[model samples]
Target chain A: MKNTYTDSGAKDTRSGFGAGLLELGRRNDRVVALCADLTGSLKMDGFKKAFPERFFQVGIAEANMMGIAAGLTIGGFIPFTGTFANFSTGRVYDQIRQSIAYSHKNVKICASHAGLTLGEDGATHQILEDIGLMRMLPGMVVINPCDYNQTKAATLAIAEHYGPVYLRFGRPKWPNFTPEDQTFEIGKAITLVEGKDVSIFATGHMVWMALQAQKLLADRGIEAEIINIHTIKPIDREAILNSVAKTGCAVTAEEHNRYGGLGDAVAQVILTAHPVPQEYVAVNDSFGESGKPEELLAKYGLTPENIAAAAVRVMERKKH
Target chain B: MSITKDIKELEAWLPQVRRDIVRMVHAVQSGHPGGSLGCTEFFVALFQYIMDHDPKKFTMDGRDQDIFFLSNGHITPVYYSVLARSGFFPIEELRTFRRINSRLQGHPATHEGLPGIRVATGSLGQGLSVALGAALAKKLNGDLHTVFTLQGDGELQEGQIWEAAMFAAHHKVDNILVTIDRNNRQIDGDVSDVMDLGDLKAKFEAFGWLVAECENGNNLIEIADALLLAKSLTRNEKPVVLIMHTEMGHGVDFMMGSHEWHGIAPNDEQLQRALEQNPETLGDY
Candidate 1:
């Protein structure tokens, strides 16, 4: 109905993970932290410094770190493992699949510096396929919070959740648009702006871009309904169906590849329930190169302009 | 938790366990028997004497108790036999090995509700890290009990083992005791030929682990003594790994030291030959 979501300030989501982890350590003694030699990069130094004995520096061994995290659950401790998203999921998929996902271990896989936003590190460090990889695993709860406050909320949220959880966040200071004190509900879509002309479903860093696109579209007289789909797996099917039914067309946006990310998740949900014309604003099937975060986002067509353009294209394809 | 110096009990127990290994694999006709037979004595020693676990109440969370993890899960036949005979499940269930809906998965799995298996293992080089995590959790919860994991000598080829090795040393997760089933044979051929693991003892020592070796891994007495020694070395600011030397398929005259038998189940005539060598003592499952 109204665009009420506003930017509180620019804060990196990785900091939220660190702050939430520190709080969790103080709140619960069973909360343990493990890192594969990138504690500072992932913003896990707070937890590590607070709980030294409880913290384990896994020393560049992500696969082993994952296994040890899975094992820690057997002794009744909730272990949050920290590393870049590239190493977190793709580097150690088999270990995560066998030791954690298959056994249903209560392990939190905290991945920072996800997507093209990682910047400068190039294609090797950026992990665009993590959402697809994690969501494909059976019984894994995948959450990619948009802003600092939501990331912190999601961090604290996953600790309370049992079984395997993949919490994806990123570096770089972006628009902190979500409510500061809002509780993060996994698998429930958060509607930031509501309009009838188009349904804009976005996740991760792209959520801010969608909000920006909502404004530009509003000026052009095309009201866009922007919904943030944080939890990708166990996707909010009802929310997607209802929003698309009203709008009659949809645009899915993400910092991930269009092949198997938010676009695919929404397509599966809407295609099954309310098949509608849908356009995607995401990374095409290709690798990214070293560049600034803003440049990479623009070069990869992951910006507000691209989102708005996709909305227009999808609306044109709508059945009259 | 102390291994009775009664070499007679383990000696009497070995033939039956060996029989179970071959019989289980032969029944499936599609499981690894070489490593299983090679590590028979080690499994018998761990389940019967090493770990402080109750089979009657097999829980995934083996709290305040010594737990064993088979990192090299291809050797499931021996693990199943040892777990069953140790009372983890009905020994008769061994008859259902690798069958439809059987808890005895081709590899160890937790989803089947199998007891004594805290984590599903078979994908190599993960067990050590999982055992370390369990050990760390025990420390957080103040669990004085220890954790044990077995890795195949061949399985050490997976890069994760080295990673886990580094983590164990740096973090001082001393509550875990990792035993390497040093049967120098993998699926392809000799481990040296497939991927040369140059001086494993030296490698572990360099990784900051308290390393030891059993002169003969398949020897019950040697395995029992080395395991007890490894147990005593825990809580010493370092993890312990026992590199026990074993043949690929020990005891079976035709299979010993041969990688060809690594995953092959004996034919009917070969099964008869294998059974004839070891006298059945504890009775068949």
Candidate 2:
């Protein structure tokens, strides 16, 4: 069945998280929010304003904040920790691994300002390895929703889920395309546009780029299947396998590094399930530096044209 | 002195607990025994007297009960032995410590569905914050029950402890007790030489905790009294801490006065000599 989507506008995904957290506070009294000195940046100020008592300002101590969030779960409080992606995973991976994931504590680690799109702030704050780090954990649920509406829905949705989760979002105000009241099913991939020629799988901000790539490929008489694989861990294997089985080739795109991001995840699915030719449109093995978001995306072969190029290359690899 | 009889019974249990610590580590040929032996009286006093808990059901929520968290998970021997003896689980389970598929992991973890552990700890400096969170939960629930946790003196070197310390003081998580096992010994050597936790009491005091020092943490009466005193100071809108001065190895002669035994499991001869020092008060597991 073919599916279609239309972009409403551009909005930051972090604002979506903020909106969802505020809703969660109203819906469930047990929902608590903790921020590590980046409430404004993470857009968690709304939840803080709405529920001051439940909001905890942990003041840049990400490790302690993670431990505290893990502890709160024992008392039936669903704690959502907000911080930059760098601090969330690389800074306090041990805490998340031990206190939350290993213990199986119900902590929602909400990370904002992920990937090279966290432009101008440079490499220190921009973290592209978060998805890989989080997905590698034993029981952590890693999510990188495409836009504002889906991110908000994911935020609210994970609160109802009863385990540790890592929700990753970006700093840039990207395109908002998903439906407003859509039900977010964890571990389910979303097919934004349906086609039969070559499957183009993407996540996070790259979904928008993939959509543009789909249009560009269509002009050149290529019917590309563009899918949003938001939930990286516990990946939607059925969706991936079915798509690759039909298309016989695939192209994966993401704003993260080429090695451990969506490409690797999709490659594993393809090799095990379908054994198809696949090309990746992601940042090669490298660290991002100071540049504008658009410049960084183009410099690292993450633009819509690049995705279309990969789709063309992968289509050629598919032997009829 | 109404608990004089109780104190006598608790004091009598220390030898067997020490025996359990040395033997549990010796059997596994791994685990920390020095700090375990040193903190024997503290555990005995906590489970037996100071803290109000039910090992019978061992509910993690601990709604009406005092909960104890072992922050320094290396000393799981004393924790496991006391937990077993206190009837949180079968004393027979002590045999399977660090064994394959055993509930008793090398570090205390809830992943194996261990009853006493509320959070996984082996990584130092995280437990105090967890304790504070539990205490905050207690406050939120209006449970009025206290939350307790134990940490090694060396564990204070981690920055998270101080962050948690600031959180506790800034938030005034009053209904909590943190006892630092001040054996002054860590894996590398004395904590002072290893990292120099200069003036620990002053540090906690500077962080705004109502600090109390117990010069004799190995004394059951002293532990019970200090904890009782800390309890009285709780809910006054300030946190409380007990800087307990304990030996690295209290009951054993050779293991004491050295950091060598801090983590090393005693050999058969060493275990026998160590067991001979305490001489089986309530019998081994």
Candidate 3:
């Protein structure tokens, strides 16, 4: 059979986010960017330089930043708030909930350095529960794109889409596996390959690992279907059920806690429709320590080998 | 009473606003009457003399005319009465206060698409930020019209107010006027006993705001003068804050002096007695 997957190279998703923001600035005058003392870290220097009048530097106050974004929406401005995942979610969750989500303000909360691979920053900086915190809010859209190209596409898409959205991406460079020219559609899962024995559902930094796991599973005579779920809230239910219906078993992989992250989100859907044997390729109940990005990924059980092993375990459980 | 208007003309409407407060509260049987009564003259002077607004064409983005936001939304009786009496809507709608499908919600909201409200602001400390944003938008659009906001003195305890205060001062947001109803009453008790806001006028001045005080917030002439001072202060220098002193339940007898009447509605007998004190001058809702 022909090789169905290809890695274009490796690139951090934050670059894609920056490029998308710059493009958005060029296209629309109503689009404004706000950052909480992380303009350089968020790769927002281009946007700031180009549209200094439209950019608002909120210093280190994430709470004030969120409220300002919500207020900016009243003037018909599409505001994108950028910060680290921890500050964006846990630190200012109430602000987002009240001012943006509950009030239904059209604000884009774009978070960088999500998950354990944020590396060297340790567990304090790495926010694994951001997706769950955002997803729980009513009328809030949660999106976690896989690679550089996908993250860029999603950033541009969310800028165009109205209402509140939480776009999450990471700091570590990953395999640029996704096609560069692909358009992003919110709440739609992309099926990368087809198989019958097991289905691999993954998101964000873990999608590339799931693809590698699919290859490993094929070598071991276990056919694994790969589904890239970029949007976690308003999740693509039809695609997940159809994949699980065909594959008979499933494994969810993500670089987050297994408690309330993508694993829990996918597991809820599976149990509701087409209940089957499944395995979660995610971090257990343990905080991460300071390490290199690659070391952290392996230490947290978010590697391709871990996914492949979970696939084998799930496939064996499918027999019962 | 200090206004230049003929006494006959002014006296005819003052009691009507007070009556509207009592009737609107009695109709819902559960709306705030104290602050509404306290803020009556300010709203009366605003809708009556100051703002060149048309009730018939209440636009959300009132480009040509000025805009007003009530941060202390529990005083909806006065606001609703002023809007209705000003011709924003029919006077009959006042009877539907807090009822199912009523435009007048317990807290003011933009979700109902009310013509007068620009944004929902029942949750305290958000209106100043929003008003500042509106002021900023007006500046960006090159519109010279200003934004006005009224927040409760007790509402100052919220942290978001300080955030907005700092932001407005830092940005030199001068096209907005924020007033605090310094009635010294809150849900718990007197503001001083509950949480002393030590020298609020000095505090705003220290925060780089042009501070103005109204000795009688219930007097139309004093309010108009305070508003003029606010206008003269509005340049590119700083924002203006009016520390308004008024009785919690200014016109009503039983509701005054104590914080117990801050948010409660009076019974039929109490309403009758209150209406007798301030006789229906224009007409009751």
lDDT of 2: 0.90
The 10 consecutive residues of candidate 3 chain B with the worst lDDT sum are B1-10
**Model 1: per-residue lDDT, tens digit, A1-320?**
67766788899999999999998999888889989889998888888887898888888788888999999899888999999999999999999999999989999999999999999999999989999999999999999999999999999888888889999999999889877788989899988888999999999889999999999899999999999999998899989999999999999999998888999999998888889999989899988889999999999999899999999999989955
Interface RMSD of each: 0.8, 0.9, 2.4
When superposed on Cα atoms, how far off is each prediction in RMSD?
1.6, 1.2, 2.8
CA lDDT, candidate 1, residue B58 = 65
Worst 10 residues of 1 chain A by lDDT: A1-10
User: Which of 1 and 3 is ahead in DockQ?
Assistant: 1
How accurate locally is residue A159 in candidate 3, as Cα lDDT from 0 to 100?
80
TM-score of the second chain, cand. 3: 0.96
What's the true lDDT of residue B22 in model 3?
Answer: 91
TM-score of chain A of each: 0.98, 0.98, 0.98
| lDDT tens digits, residue span A143-260, model 2 | 9999999999999899889899999998888989899999999999988888899999999999999999888988998888888999998899999998888888999999898888
Off by over 4 Å in 1: B1-5
- Per-prediction TM-score: 0.97, 0.98, 0.92
TM-score of 2: 0.98
- Residues A231-308 of candidate 3 have per-residue lDDT tens digits of 998899999899999988889998888888888888899899879988999889777879998999888888999999
In order of TM-score, best first, we have 2, 1, 3
